[model samples]
Target chain A: MKKLLLAAALSALATGAAWADTVRLGTEGAYPPYNFINDKGEVDGFERELGDEICKRAALDCTWVTNEWDSIIPNLVSSNYDAIIAGMSVTAERDEVIDFTNEYIPPSPSGYVGLAGGSVDVAKGIIAAQINTIQAGHVASSGATLVEFASPDETVAAVKNGEADAVLADKDFLAPIVAESGGMLAFIADDVSIGGGVALGLRESDGELKAKMNTAIDAMKADGTLNTMLVKWFKDAAPQW
Target chain B: MFEICAEPRSLEGLTWLSCYLTTPKHAAMYYSILTVLGLLLAVVPPILFLGFAGALARRSKIAPVRWLGVGYTSIVRGVPDIVFFLFFPIALDQAVEYIRHKIKCADVLEPVYQGNDFVVCQAAKMPLGIADQFYHEAWGFSLAVITFAIVFGAFTANTLHGALNAVPKGQLETARAFGMSERQTFWRVHMPQMWVYALPGLSNLWMILIKATPLLFLLGVKDIVYWAKELGGMKTQVYTYAHPDWRIWYFGALLVFYLFLTWVSQRAFDRIFARASRGLSVAS
Candidate 1:
């Protein structure tokens, strides 16, 4: 009877492992082009498409989860999600906490979009950006205030509220903020940009999962799926890198 | 022989520091932030009072009053503050404009909500068409204060209502037997005693209010958090004091400032607690 009970427990564990197909993914849904929520409350944009493609390639069924940007890393550490597909930039500090797949989107020029004013020459001074942007590294010497925020919305709101003179964001993301500024703010020259591009990440413990993602990303780039989605979101101003 | 204050140096350390600190515009902003903090402190009290009324109404004998009070507190608590901070200012601004739109542009026939855009007659703009930049700032501050008050007030009301019920029922009965009116008894006996019970909760609410001042940046008021970020970034060759990324230091200073504020408030609350409990002695 004891042998029969032990066998039953092993079989139950195997069945549970076989039936699990869910891959919880997390992202800051407020950022556009990378990831954003549409008016209909559905998550869409480049990151979603990339995540779906990667899941298909890896043969893992996945669902994307919206999480606060500051909490994303901690949540992953706590096993809240198996993966993060947010437009997270790879940096030495963040790399210390999580393992990232190889460079997917390369660096793009980053700068601020603000109102046309003598108070801020977006070309000249301190700036604000979503936390963890490469533009932060470049603008460190610009003598301009570098206000870091968790969401693209907060960065843009900083501009609107006049708390931030300008924002350091992708040229694509800045376009919406500029348009919405309603003449209160405008973008400086786009030639003065900073930041490499975004990346998908996972907890460092998940080394095997990282390898599968790199394979999927390579397939997406090779098959032109990445470029197609890039054009759909970025349009004429898409980063060439 | 050393020169003793004979030739004025182009920009000495003290002179540069003095000029930077004394700049007229900078001075104005220094005082302006204090005004903003004062505005915040001044505006929050009425909200607490309103919240108390709402909580009492929710606990009222009348069903409708109780439902209204319950609905207000629960709905505010349910939604994330980010949503309320985003929604309230815009909603209030639009609501005010709609009223003005009716008054000033009654003949206009275009619908207000037109495909994600809210269009109102130019004449209906709050503060009218000719207001200056300062007017806009004042209006924004007003909106922020109201939003903070409303949100925090609900929490205060919940605290106060609990304190009200905790008052010993025998005290009220004695007051009634002595021919005191209900209103007089509430003011003379119940209200004064409620503070003793309410102090702990009220003190916690004060800390929440203090920590929440940073959210004023979200509302568009340039409080110290905004300035700290602005001043703390590295300046290049163009500026006199060039440096590297110094945001960590700036944020560190802000953390200290907040910590100090909390510490001072905690000390003050302890004194008040002791003073309130002066006559009563617990077993040593």
Candidate 2:
């Protein structure tokens, strides 16, 4: 029994050592198109496909891990995962804590969705945005009453419930919702482009891994596979290389 | 689900609500109630065992054992439960990872702490990075259970200690005069009597435990509170079952659910209290 226990422990250690070589990709599975949990309960969306392709191109073993969006960056820094591919927009504030590979998806505009025909002055009226997003930062600095929610769904709900005059979020995210709202929702203001493009977030110490991923992203861009995925997921809004 | 649920946006009134209440997300919400109940049921045995051991340790003749028990109860009871709830899981997670990092990455020379980051090798992750989603969820739920047990066990210890003392000294003396061993006297006279005094405090603790199930959200377990906030928020036409901001109704449902739990708990405790107090000379 003692010998068998020792053997089991040794094998467990061996497996743990093997796991060290695999890069873990952390993502927020709540956001659709970028990343979302499909009905099958696996991470399935644009980023999931892109991340898998990037791993294959880099010849690196990788695994997907879902994390809540609020702690995605902190968790990455804390070694909860090797990199973040959670549709995170590159911002100077974020770059202070972690490094980013070159942007895979270009800057998408942020737009305000509101009840159709409502007089929502974007500069002064109450606006809702997901907490810790570029839109929330913009609204907070723009002198509007910014109501921040933890999820994108709640921001839209805020607009519909009359809790806020409008909700500012990614145009790609809001456009589909607005179109499908049956005229109950519409763009209330001009789109505002903020932050750099979306990129994979990595810890500052993981420069080798970042370089490997950046090379993979560049390869995809050069081969047009990247553009095809963008077009498939974002449709007309996709910024082709 | 009804056929009208196929085009949920087209329906209104009771039909829409009927369909809305049974969406997959709502179903998940309903299942989360079981998560709360499971936590309660799983936690009780550990709590009672810990409480019993703690009370006995405090009553021990050995000085160090008594101090150990006293220290455990006092330190845990002194801190607010919310603070413990927030701190324990993160600290425990990091501690586990830190030990794993030491064992798994012995060859790595770099220190684990670099500035604000608690950098550990990928192998040191609590659930291996490649593990399925169910494993991750189970790991988090397990951590939540341990945390609840530790915090609530301390309170239970203090209550049990007091109840042990509340058992009459004269009854124990009579048992001793009849030549009963100390162990026999405790089991026959003291332990049975201790329950009557302990029941009131235990009942209060149980009610608090039920209410504290909502705090599982803070620990990142998808308990009912997490689902309530997620499902109750307004879903737009992009969703299959679009709804207006119905958070009030969703939270209202949660309100009723919690009230029902406490109401049932109150009746159950009352029956237990009456049964325990039976044939005793103590005033009802």
Candidate 3:
């Protein structure tokens, strides 16, 4: 009876773990087009549709979890979730901590958006980017003062408030904001590409799960479905898969 | 709002402002303040009850109960409270779902410890797999509350234990001389008298609880802080309302909100202490 009880308890813990089929896909639901919380408050956007297709083809039970952008990668390392589908680009600094599957969305250009007549000097003027993002890296190296904010909205806000002379972010992301600025803001510089294109980040140890997801992602890339999504959401800014 | 919002770009000054504040997301931010208030009101009663149990257990003659109570109180003090706040919800959620998964899917032969992932059966998912948005939010909120109650309960227990000791020995002896049993003496004499002593510490605990509501953001709940960040940032042309970086303004509003809450709390605690101390001697 004691041995049986011990076995049951151990199996109970094993049973509770992902030893089952479901994979929890973690994303920051704050970014638009890539991923955002919709009016119904569910995760919606390009990645949502694309991630669903990957799960469908890969034959894995996938669930969506939204985590804060700043801690998304660390949370995956700590086993809070299995994968990060957040709009994170592949960067050398991050590669030290987590592994990437493959380039799903090819690296697109990043641009600087500033007040229409008050362009940031780029050499010395303060520039803002969302915290831990690749654009922040480019700003850090470009001889401009770098300011970081927790969310993309705040980065744009920094430019509007004069806290930042300009905000460096994905061109596609800043395009709509500039259009909405109604002549208040405009692109101040040429598009500068940074990092490899965005990819799914997994724990370094999650090789099997990574293999499964990569297969699904590669399949998406093969049939032009990936480009279809890129065009639908990113329009002219999308790079061909 | 209907009129001012019509030509968002054309309007300026306070007219533009009126429409901006009335955006649907701003309304959600306002409602989130009430959510924080609701959490405060809901968690306190249970915390007090837990404290009462802990104090009694500590005072009990039984050796293990006293040790258990002592352990509960002392252990929480050495570790930072915020650690508990951060750790509890995720751990508890997994633990709860884990238990449910075991019973619901007994025949499953595979191990659950897949790397970096914790997968459970579909039916065992909390709020179930297809729960509404409200259910999901409420479930997360509930986990946050329980985490707060448990962590704060330990602090409250320590305070109540000290308060229990502060009650005069003469009062207990007098109650016993008047034919009161141990249980009766506790209920009739010790518990009532201890309140005057406990009120000051409990009030301090209450303030900490009030200030700590901001930590709900860490638990992934869309509390006031989350909404403030979401709604205050500049909205571009695509949004119905657009603005420049207004974070300083939004955060200023939040600072005032918390200040008002703390001010009211201080006044109410002062009144509570005054009433509780009504008949006690000045020295006592």
Candidate 4:
């Protein structure tokens, strides 16, 4: 009886190892449209839908994991998840540590939003951006005093409370706030085109997984499903193929 | 979790709140309260053990042992707790990975610290690259516990050391005059009398430890404070549970939780102090 019990436990462990093969996709669930935790508390947004479709097309079992924005890249490298589909923009500095799949979302303009009727001198005034983002890197180098925030919401909050002269972020993310602010917030400066577009980030060591994801992304692009998703999530602000 | 939760945007009143509080994310927040308690329970044994060890070492006859204990208590107590909380976990993680890299990747020629990155072979990861998610979380939590133990242990050492001295010198001298060895007197007499003096300081330390649980979020443990911030942020119509910024309400809830915990702790400590101080004339 003891031997039989040991065998049963060993079989259970084997099945557990097999079930661990599912690919895990990581995202920051705080950013809306790109990603956000819905009322059901599941990861829901453009990236969520796109990641699921890609997994289905590639014939791979996948699960979602939420991580803080600042540590997203490090966590991916440390193998916390198989991929980062958190609307991360492709940049040369990031390319050194991790590899990227082909672009899923086209390059979009980043705009500065400030209080209505206020003039923001982009060159000299303090601008807010989420830390470790391409926009933050741009703000830091664009001759502006950059105040970095941990979350995207804090950047917008900084602008509303007059802690910053303006908050610069992706136009798609900023557009909805501008529309809903009742004329309290408006675009204060010309949009700046930055980054090489957004894509799925993967560990450099995971070549096979990277190839499979790239194939699925290409299939989505070819069938216009990716474009449909972009429009649905970003409305008219989405840059199309 | 309920059928009505399917359309959260349409939710209203108590029904909406029930669904809101029962979401998976909210469930995680509820579980994090237990995480804070678990850390407190798990840390106490190590803290007391280290405190006793440190206090004894300082009283050692050997000069080196005495210096080691003195250095530990003085150095750790001198640094700000927040700096130690932030620095220890990352430094310890890298140190573990670095040692593993040296052993597992002996043939690799590139340095471990290249430019800004700490590159290690996939096999050298602390939990191993293919380990389960449960292992990853457990690893983070264990690191948080150790950091807490180390910082709190130093303060505990100082309190225990003071208590050891505060045990009236006449009592220990009387034991020595009765032909008792120093070790026998320390274990049987001095240790028993030391508790009366230690209870007050230890109670203060316990309250501080309870308050420090919120800092677990800094070490990436997903404690209650992290969830409060995430759930309280503004949500637009695109989200299922659309709500305005409700951070004030969430923070208010945290305030009540902390006050209740401290209140319960205070009552328990009062009882323990009363019982321990029984025949002694020490103020309760």
DockQ of each: 0.02, 0.32, 0.23, 0.28
Could you say which candidate leads in lDDT? 4
What lDDT tens digits, residue by residue, belong to model 1 across residues B1-284?
A: 12332322345677554554444433544665585567657766777787778767876989998888888887877788888987788778889878767866799998765433355655665543334435555776888888888888778778888888887888889999999998899898877777788889989988888888877766556577765554454332223333344667767977887798889989999999888766644211
lDDT per residue (tens digit) for residues A1-241 in model 4: 9999988964553332323347879999888889998766689999999999999999988888788898888777756577999889999999999899999998889999999998889889999999999999999999999999999988988888889999999998889878878799999899999998999998877778889999999999999999999999999888887
> What is the full ranking by TM-score, best candidate first?
4, 2, 3, 1
Q: Each candidate: what lDDT?
A: 0.68, 0.85, 0.81, 0.86
Q: What DockQ results for candidate 4?
A: 0.28
lDDT of 1 by residue, A15-103 (tens): 32223455668887666667765323356777888789889999987776666676677656534456888777777777877778876
Cα lDDT, model 2, residue A54: 95
What is the alpha-carbon lDDT for the whole of candidate 4?
A: 0.86
Q: If both were scored by TM-score, which would come out higher, candidate 1 or candidate 2?
A: 2
Reference-based lDDT, residue B243, model 1: 35
**Worst ten in a row by lDDT for model 2 chain B:** B233-242
DockQ of candidate 1, scored on C-alphas against the true complex (2 decimals): 0.02
For B50-89, candidate 4 gives per-residue lDDT tens digits of 8988888898889999999999999999999889986788
Chain B of candidate 4 achieves a TM-score of 0.96
Off by over 4 Å in 1: A1-241, B1-12, B23-29, B238-241, B278-284
Best by DockQ: 2
Q: Which candidate has the top score in TM-score?
A: 4
